[model samples]
Target chain A: MTPMTLADAANLHTFVDALRFIGDHPGFLAQKALEQLELSGAALGIAIAVALPLGVVLGHFHRGSGVAIGASIVGRALPSLVLIAAFLTLLGIGFVNNMVALAVLGSGPILTNSYDGVDRVDNEIAESARGMGMTGWQIVRRIELPLAIPLLFTGIRIAAVTIVATAPIAAIAGGGGLGDVIVNQASYRLSGVLGASLCVMALSALVFVALAGIQIGVTPRGLRGTTVVHDHSRKEQQ
Target chain B: MQSHWGDTLQPALVQHIELTAIAVVLGFAIAFPLALLAHRYRKLEHPIGVFSALLYTIPSLALFQLLIPFTGLTWTTVEVALVAYTLVILFPNIVAGLHSAPDEVLEAARGMGLTRMQTLTQVELPLAIPAIVGGLRVAVVSTVAIATIAAFLLPDGLGYPIVLALKEPTPFKTEIYSAGALAISFALLCDLALVALRRALAPWAARGLA
Candidate 1:
């Protein structure tokens, strides 16, 4: 139990001050975080809405899959900053512009993975579905989408991570979010910046973990059974 | 054509190309051998890969701040960050490419009396070239885009025009958008060049295209 040094006391004072600042500004931080959450959520929604349908359609019509692939490549190649600026020009900066930019970024992974997943589905199963007089939509809904779901989810997981990570850039362009807190507060209050950045990191990690959990949970047991059955049949054939 | 937007575009485009080319070439020059060394040493690979990954994960602005004490406000800071980013995308790729050479191919080359260097150059490197080139493409595009963000610290590149526009009144917003579009188009062109280069260098990988 030696006496505290001056350096130690100063360190303690800084730490206590940081804690007090956070305590006093809880609403500010929460509001910022909520804005980020809302923007991300909307972006994710729009991404899934557009990407899934486009992916499935392009995958089904495999004759011209290059179009979708080309689009995804363009999307991926375009910088998120550029996309944000483009949206800002058209929609003006705010929640809607941020949402559009993020959605465009998010679309690439989801669309590409979805196309790959559905394209890789067992062709024989699709032929069999057609042989049974099933419609194209039925074949997709029953056979293709189900089999492709896991890979589709993997794409979504990637998109989710990208959106969460890049969402902070929105703050720079006047879209309010955790990034605003980090960028603005960091100029004066280093502790606030650190706190906001930590929150962002935690949020990204949480989103990734949650998506992983959802993937594990939603994969149907019957699909595993079917995979096992296919393997068994292949072994017997050999 | 006589507007302020036009005034900003011409100089900004030149600066944009100059900065991007310098950063990309420098980053690749640094990344290639570092990747090779990391791949050669089993003990060094994981740690180096993880370190590069961690550096990449740190936000650009944070990395800038971290480097400020040593680099001050110079382009050196931005160059360091760009190079660090290239390593994250390039190292794993080179390692994977080297490892992708079939083990049997190496053994056969050795059995045929080829030395280690001979085996690497003749057998492993050719096989790895496609993947290495692919990684380079990714690295180049990523660095080009990220380099724009560096303009906040340094007064150069297409980002200068965009930042200037941001500071101006409402009527000048189009200048920002146009400059940004130009930047994106430049990235897109670089991406296309990489794809074409990859296909040209690795013709086998490009088979089935009419």
Candidate 2:
């Protein structure tokens, strides 16, 4: 079918009417979008729960970074749909499979970045921490973890955006989300698609802004100054 | 259902290979020039980056649906969307690789009476190859994996099995999961190959001494 055109305004209006009819029924656009938002949050929660500790442990071990990186690469290398399919096969369809696939996908960058952040902490600081007879956990908690917080937060932010944006794919496995609304609109030529897409975009933007605010709020002023100075020095060295 | 493994698996594998190869090649063709343009004009980088970021944010299914009106659910549509997706991964790598070349090295090349084209081709391009290839590796793996999603629109591939598995009456979901496992394994193998290739072509670069 040809794409509905501006000239087909009447048809578009009919489509809008159909969407309104669907909205009046149970489990429509607004409900589906809310369900998706919740699912996205759950998926992100799972990713952070799994990835943060793994990343910290891998960073501590040093040997495990390669393994973690490899895992992340694999996570990224797998298509979202394929992941959905794989999860669906094993777990059957619903929130669980969708959550697993999205969490897996979202975990990679977060894990990688967290590991990198911890690993890239100045060796001197770590050496001093050890020299002071600090326990391994103490060093990680006091020195490495605080220093890595900003970078780790960056990864989490990226993962949040990615999960929220891609959450619609869950609809394919019969997990309701904004994606379902988009698909429904396409199949039925309704106006709900536009509204649903707009909602998704709005949610994504809100998440991004909120994360940025959190990052700024959490960052230490001294570290921020050091980062700026470091950038300047690097530029001068170059 | 076809009982013969080769009848179902081989053709799908071959089709998967062909589709990924074509998409990677074409994606590089477009991404390289765009990267070059963005590198040349710093102002252009923002718009290009934003465009790719937006493209990256677009769900693959939604992107395919958007293209359907223009490309009619054909191989062309699938390939184009795959290429577009690849560009998002590759463009940043290419631009970063080029920019990573030391200013002194570039100045020396110019001092030696090299033209801009010659400097880019001989001096910059050679130096940037490893980084560009790193990006290409990412593109290749990503495109291969995402290519499976094209089965939703395309005629045949590993994704066909996935779709069929969803439709089948049998409880054996292994058929779909196995295909996904194979696809992921194939991606890992290709990634390893790229790593080996990078090591061979640029040992110093690989060793981080470059």
Candidate 3:
């Protein structure tokens, strides 16, 4: 199907129609949103569970070992499409498969940020904690983990936004998401595409805000302002 | 269809590469200037950075569809989203890399009577290679990945085979796997090449004693 023209996209009727369509079938759009959210949440949850610990442990050891860097780099660089497509071939089509693919794609940022967050903890802080008879676990639990909250959630936030944004592609695997609306241009046409895009973007924005709130909530209020906004996470988005 | 697998897979790979090149090269071209502008004007960084960051968050699918009205399912449409996706990474890297140049080193260049532009070109830029290249590596890899999805916009990409296979009554597993492998392989190849490029561009980075 050919794409919509500028006129169609700009026509006041388009926005009105799209909004009406969304209003008319709130259930369908809501279901799509929930499905997208579920897949995104599952994908990011798996990624954080796996990559977060690995990153935190590697960071706690203060090891800049090649494994840490190599893993994050490769993880960040691997595209979601490749993972999704590859999994589709191997696993056919399933919710579990889509989650794994997204986990693979999202793991890099989590790993990288977690590692960086822990690795960059002030030596004085760790040493002071150690000097006070803190065990390795104690130091990690008290000093490092608290300090790393900003970065840890930053990683999760990046993963969350990315997963939410990319979950639509799950449609190709027979997984439900807004991606179906975008692809089925025949039925939806311009408004469907535009409306779906709006929904997906809204989902992403909601995910980001919700995660950011968590990041801030966990962070010590004083340190909150200083937790650098990791805007460079664009690499993870596609 | 039993014959000439070369004609098919080869072009798909090349087209992916061409798409990557167009997107990255042009992305860098636009990003570098913007980076410089942001660097020169500190106030610009916040707005420009925020804008790019917001743009960055817009999913590739939405962004591509968002442009269909203007670009209309053409290669240009794909490239627009691809390039926009790149800017968020590229701009920050260029500016940060430039800013990351050690003040003393920059002062030393200035002390040697190099003009501002001369200092930037001769000393700062070389010093900035690692970060800039780091950004480039990410940009290239992600662009390659994003371009796979671009097949939904325009044909003749690795994504084409995957999309096509899905449409088949029984989607051929090998076909999907092979295309996926090639796309992943192409991204890795670009990444490795850029690693080598960074090393070649700034040999001092390896030694770390700079």
Winner on lDDT (1 vs 3) = 3
TM-score: the better of candidates 1 and 2: 2
Ranking by TM-score: 3, 2, 1
Indicate the worst ten consecutive residues by lDDT in candidate 1 chain A: A227-236
lDDT of 2 by residue, A76-145 (tens): 6787777777787778878999999899989988898788778767666777999999999999999888
Query: For each predicted model, how many residue pairs clash, with residues at least 3 apart or on different chains?
Result: 0, 0, 0
Quality class of the docking in candidate 1, CAPRI style: incorrect
Ranking of all predicted structures according to DockQ, beginning with the best and ending with the worst: 3, 2, 1
Off by over 4 Å in 2: A1-27, A131-134, A182-213, A222-238, B1-4, B169-171, B208-210
Residue-pair clashes, model 2: 0
**In what order do the candidates fall by lDDT, top score first?**
3, 2, 1
Clashing pairs in 1: none
Highest-lDDT candidate: 3
**Inter-residue clash pairs, candidate 3:** none
